[model samples]
Target: MVIFGLTAVVVVGGGAFVAKRSYDNSKIVPTPITPEDFGKIALGDLYAPDPKADAYKAAAVTAYKKDKLKNARKGVAALDWIEIKDKGPGGDGFPQANFPPGSNPSPGSNKGVAKTMLSSFGFGAEQWGCLEKLWMKESGWNERAMNRYSGAYGIPQSLPGSKMASAGSDWQTNAATQIKWGLGYIKGRYGTPCGAWGHSQAKGWY
Candidate 1:
């Protein structure tokens, strides 16, 4: 009987020892949390700084401020006063001398009329290019051109066509009259032909 009791105690103790060993082997040990690891976990890679990109941005800002200061020091001239009078041809105020002598473009050809009129609006040859492109896309320079969908008409494609009457009573039949109104409109709305053309290019209309 005593031998059997001793054998049972040894078996129980051995099973407990084996169970404890298994538990210890299966247990997961936690890794030590370092400061760097905590930073990565909380803020991710955002904690890292890009010195080159920061330097470039700082340089760009400094350059922009310097340029602004230079421009401020170099005072800008006011734009030349433009007077829209009713003394010239078609009762539009632009002076006759503004039109280059012998610039009588062929009747019904709107481009020649526009080129002659550009000087009156303070535009140069460079502006003529932009005006040409703008009108070509709008009406192909055809004085009678009409958009059936939008009801815009004339070489300038003035909406309702009557707006050109502000320049002359012959707005419908006269390319010169239409061109005058168109130039006025461009100056008022866009400041220049290139400005109008740029807007047209971006939005498919001016």
Candidate 2:
């Protein structure tokens, strides 16, 4: 009986030791938490708003916009001014002649008026050759020139003759008035006389 009791006590002690060892081995070790991570975890959110970071991002955006605006202003300041030449007929310009307003005029006289007026619309004498050629093909610089089929009229060959009335009441008879309307039309549509000439050359019409 003494041996049996001793054996039972040993068996129970061995089982207790195995159970303790298994419990120790199964225990989880916690990872060390950084101060920042602990704060986030304590707040129950992984992503916390950082005021300093937000301010830095906002400041960087504002600085980029200011730099972009400064460069734009510099670009604007670097642009060159366009020079406009003198007005009125005569002095080494093409088809040079002085014609009184009421005088009967020819194509050459009409060209004289056009050359003087070119500068008013910011064109140089270099543009006159193209202007002359364009009008010569369109209406031969005639104030009363008319297209029977298209109803285009005057030096610029405006589709309707009445369109020249915007320049003056005597658009039908006055070469200067017709030239003014024509130049204004050319400027609005083609930017320059040469541009109009180029379009006319390519398309057979300006």
Candidate 3:
């Protein structure tokens, strides 16, 4: 009877040790995403002023990669929204579009506008050609173009649309607003239009 009691204690102690080890390992790694958490998700572009959005997105993507979520669009949308929102008027060190009253006219076409901005960026024809191709593929230089799948809108394809308001109040209707934002994005992210084009080519999206 004493031997049997000793054997039962060993079994229980071994089980307890294994359970404790699993709990410790879980704390070191990311918490496994569960179906309940997945059900709470409904993806949409968030405005940038919300400081917690990036961290949320990062966690969501991490969970998605772990096969806990249905799609990574939730994560991609998170990144796109913030990038565009940072260009908004008064967005932390970015230029605000403060055109003299009526100095900025509505664009009838985006023709020549992109080229002018390209030159201003110190990019020559080689860079211009790449940018032209890149934008053409992304939105055909259409200020009003919107991606139905990702909710990205405008020439630079700023997610959530409102983020372009930093470039101008007339973001929705103005070609120049979109171009300005797009140029800023290229300069910041890739250092040059060709660089962005290269990334787009390799990644299937810039």
Best by TM-score: 2
lDDT (Cα atoms) of all candidates against the true structure = 0.56, 0.57, 0.53
Candidate 3 has an lDDT of 0.53
- In model 2, the runs with Cα more than 4 Å from the true position are 1-104
Distance from true location, Cα of 187 in model 1, Å: 0.4
Number of the candidate with higher TM-score, 1 or 2: 2
Ranking by TM-score: 2, 3, 1
Put down candidate 3 lDDT per residue, 113-153, tens digits, no spaces. 88777777667777877887887766667665654323356
Better of 2 and 3 by TM-score: 2
The worst-scoring run of ten residues by lDDT in candidate 1 lies at 79-88
Model 2 CA lDDT for position 106: 85
lDDT by residue for model 1 (1-206), tens:
54344334334443342344336433535345467644543442321333432332233233333444545567754211111212122112211123334443243467888999999988888898899998887777766565432335667666445556567656656678889888877887788999989987875556
In candidate 3, the residue pairs with backbone N, CA or C atoms under 3 Å apart (3 or more residues apart, or in different chains) clash, namely: 88-166, 89-166
Span of ten consecutive residues with least summed lDDT in model 3: 79-88
Q: Rank by lDDT, highest first.
A: 2, 1, 3
Each prediction's RMSD to truth: 36.4, 41.0, 18.3
Which residues of candidate 1, in runs, are more than 4 Å off?
1-108
In model 1, how large is the Cα lDDT of residue 160? 41
| TM-score against truth, every candidate | 0.48, 0.50, 0.49
- Best model per lDDT: 2
